[model samples]
Target: MRRKLAAGNWKMNGSLSAMAEVQALCEAHPEPKVDMLLCPPATLIWPMASMRGEHPLAVGAQDCHPEDKGAHTGDIAAPMLREAGATAVIVGHSERRADHGESSETVRAKAEAAHRAGLLAVVCVGETLEEREAGRALEVVGEQLAASLPPGSTGETVVVAYEPVWAIGTGKVAGTEEIGEMHGFLREALRKSHPEAADAIRLLYGGSVKGSNAAEIFAVPDVDGALVGGASLTAEQFSPIVTALEGA
Candidate 1:
């Protein structure tokens, strides 16, 4: 079975003092049934990772460079992230696409880089609000999954996160049936490319996920877990999301 995870994307937020949240999250619940990971800003990963080693909590990086090391200014490569104590890294977030103009090929290269560095890669793919309204959400997401995934892809090296471009950080969520359809399509797509990946790769939903609505969204047929947002910054808010998943 795919391990259920409540991965948090701090997303351009947090500072030295903000590490308190990470500590609290770790302290509040040490033996969670589902997995818990936090993807904080690059600057804080190492310090936060030192908080504890035995809990289910793991520190992750928000982004990573495709190249191991280079003259690329303002880029943190996978090896650098690994050195910083991150067990995983998020790549291809919509913000990266909009702000840095990252493409499918670049994300694929980054995913490969993560694999090479032994860091779990959580690859994000989704359609923008316009595409959803235009009836091309699935098509856009499919193209992304096809073109961006690394060659020889398997469940072990990757995790897929589906976050609608519009819904992310907008307090909006894909409806239950819509989520089921998208995740189901993703499962079939993965199987078509790598039949052995069945029931291995965890599929996570992101974008405005919170305790109030987590269970409803997670209960969908193919919804394995979530990549939490604002709610995950705190233990009180994030725990309920995990707790809900258990009951679901």
Candidate 2:
């Protein structure tokens, strides 16, 4: 069975002071029934990982360079992140695609790099508001998922997060039906390539996930967990969501 995961993305936020939340979160669920992950900004990965102690909390990186090493001045490669105590890295987040003009192929390359570095790649796929309005949400995400995933993806090495572009950080979440449809479709799509491992792969829903609505969202079929945003910055705000997933 796929273990439920409560993953948080701090994005460009958090600092050394903010590490308190990580300690508090770990203390709150030292023996949580489900998995917990926190993807802090690259600067905090080492400190956050170090502070976790014997807790089950896993620290991750928000993004990583596709190449193992190069002349890239501002890019941190997957291996570098792994050395900094990160066990996973998020790829293809909408912000990277929009702000950095990253393509699906670039995302695929980064996922491959993550695997080469022995890190789990949390590959993200989502449709923008315009695409959803144009009735191409499924089509858009399907293509992105197919192209963004690495060729040898497996349940242990990859985690797929479905975060609608418009819903992220907007206090708006896709309806349960919408989430279910996309997650089910994603599972079917994963099966086409990794039929034996598709069912073992954990599918996470993202975009405006919080304590207030987490349980309801978790009730949706095929939603193995969530990739939380704003609410994850604090233990009080995030613990409830983790508890909800534990009971899911």
lDDT of each residue in 1-248, candidate 2, tens digit only: 99999999999898999989888888888899999999999999999999888887999998998899989999999999999999999999999999999999999999999999999999999999999999999999999999998887899999999999999999999999999999999999988978988999999999999899999999999999999999999999999999999989
The models' CA-based lDDT, in order, is 0.88, 0.95
Residues 1-248, candidate 1: write the lDDT tens digits.
77788899988888888877777777777787888889989998988888766776889998898999989998889999999999999999999988999998999999999999999999999999999999999999999999888877677789999999898889888898899999999999988876788568889999899899998998898788999888887878988898888777
- TM-scores for all candidates? 0.97, 0.99
Model 1 deviation from native, Cα RMSD in Å: 1.1
Which prediction has the highest lDDT against the true structure? 2
lDDT of 2: 0.95
lDDT of 1 at 190: 88
- Can you tell me which runs of candidate 1 are displaced by over 4 Å? none
